[model samples]
Target: MEMLTLECPYCGVQADETELHAGGEAHLTRFGPGSSDADFEAYLFMRENPKGVHFERWRHVNGCGKWFHAARCTMTLEVFGTYPAQTAEPPKKIRDAITAKRPGWTWRELS
Candidate 1:
């Protein structure tokens, strides 16, 4: 397995994989109480495991102890950028970086 060195979007510190924790996929809708069983199941288990570009949640445990989203390539382990966790979508800069590297990539209808 390869290691990833990502920059903490909050603290601006570059940390290796050992200093951070992987929090699975980012930008997922949460299903709380009163939601259907299927919706809750999907929320708990369903996730995108693509072979190429991917976005994921990462916590800067050793640095600022804050969570952020990272855009990277699953196949090549190339990190495009990292952004604040609170962002609703990937920022324009990150998207542009992915575009420059990927050419024709799209995630959940955002191209």
Candidate 2:
């Protein structure tokens, strides 16, 4: 495993992996009290572990102390870009970067 570095979207600081905490996959649908047990279980545990491009949540624990989203490649560990956590989807710039590196790549039908 190589050392991972990510830029904090809020603070614009390039931070090493030690300064950040991974928060698992991003853009998950939350299932609450009224939801079925299976839905809740899937919400909590199920995740897409793709071999290629992946979107993930990361917290800049030692920088801005804020969460952000990162589009990266699982196989090569190449980060496409990072964006604010509040965004509902990957920004066009990030998506373009990924597509430039990997043509025909799609993220949950957002290709």
Candidate 3:
């Protein structure tokens, strides 16, 4: 799939489609022992296909080579913001933007 121009948050480089690689969903915690099959399936395959706020991972393959998280709207394909992949959750600004755009929407705290 063709990717759009992505700006690297770490190095401040605007990477073209060819310079970046799309990673799958971010912030996934691996299921361990004592977990049921359904739970494992949810972690490995079942993903959120929401029409509103979504978060994804991107790698600046040909530029900074750092992984970052991008928050975007699935319906509009509008990018809200991006940040380092090491973060545990979406930044406050991104959350605020999404909340403003999608009134009454609240982010669920992942267990």
Candidate 4:
């Protein structure tokens, strides 16, 4: 199996893929009880899987055991930046970098 590495923003640890776990798309707002069926459904299954800049969640499972968010390009597989998982939106620096690389990119607070 090919090996990969992801840096943990919280602990500053560089861990191999085996030491990390993917948590899926990041910055997802929870659709709790009482949410409309449509909202729940969207939360359960909807994802852009966008071809360009994408935000994702990951954990340093075998290392710091902390979760963090990563902004990466789905096409090029290049990571633009990583930030704490608790953040509700992409950091400004990361957004700027993405804009610089992918001109005319639209950034959404909840996408």
- List the global CA lDDT of all models: 0.91, 0.92, 0.77, 0.82
Which candidate order results from sorting by TM-score in descending order? 1, 2, 4, 3
RMSD of each: 1.5, 1.5, 2.9, 2.2
The count of residue-pair clashes in candidate 4 stands at: 0
lDDT of 3 at 76: 66
Model 1 TM-score on a 0 to 1 scale: 0.91
lDDT of 1: 0.91
Clash count, predicted structure 2 = 0
TM-score of 2: 0.90
lDDT of 4 by residue, 1-75 (tens): 445567799898877778889999888778989999999998999876788788889989998899998888877
Global lDDT for candidate 3? 0.77
Model 3: which ten-residue window has the lowest total lDDT?
A: 102-111
What shift in Å separates residue 109 of candidate 4 from its native position after superposition?
A: 5.6
Error of 3 at 5 (Å): 3.2
Pairs in clash, predicted candidate 4? none
Compute each candidate's TM-score over C-alphas: 0.91, 0.90, 0.80, 0.87
For candidate 3, write residues 1-111 as lDDT tens digits: 544566689998877768888887777777878899988988889777677777889999887789998877767667777889888788788788777777676444531
**RMSD of candidate 1 to true structure, Å:** 1.5
- Model 1 alpha-carbon miss at residue 4, Å: 1.0
- Tens digits of lDDT, candidate 2, 51-104: 999999999998889999999999888999999999878889999899999999
Residue 15 of candidate 1: its Cα lDDT?
A: 92
C-alpha lDDT (0 to 100) for residue 96 of candidate 3: 83
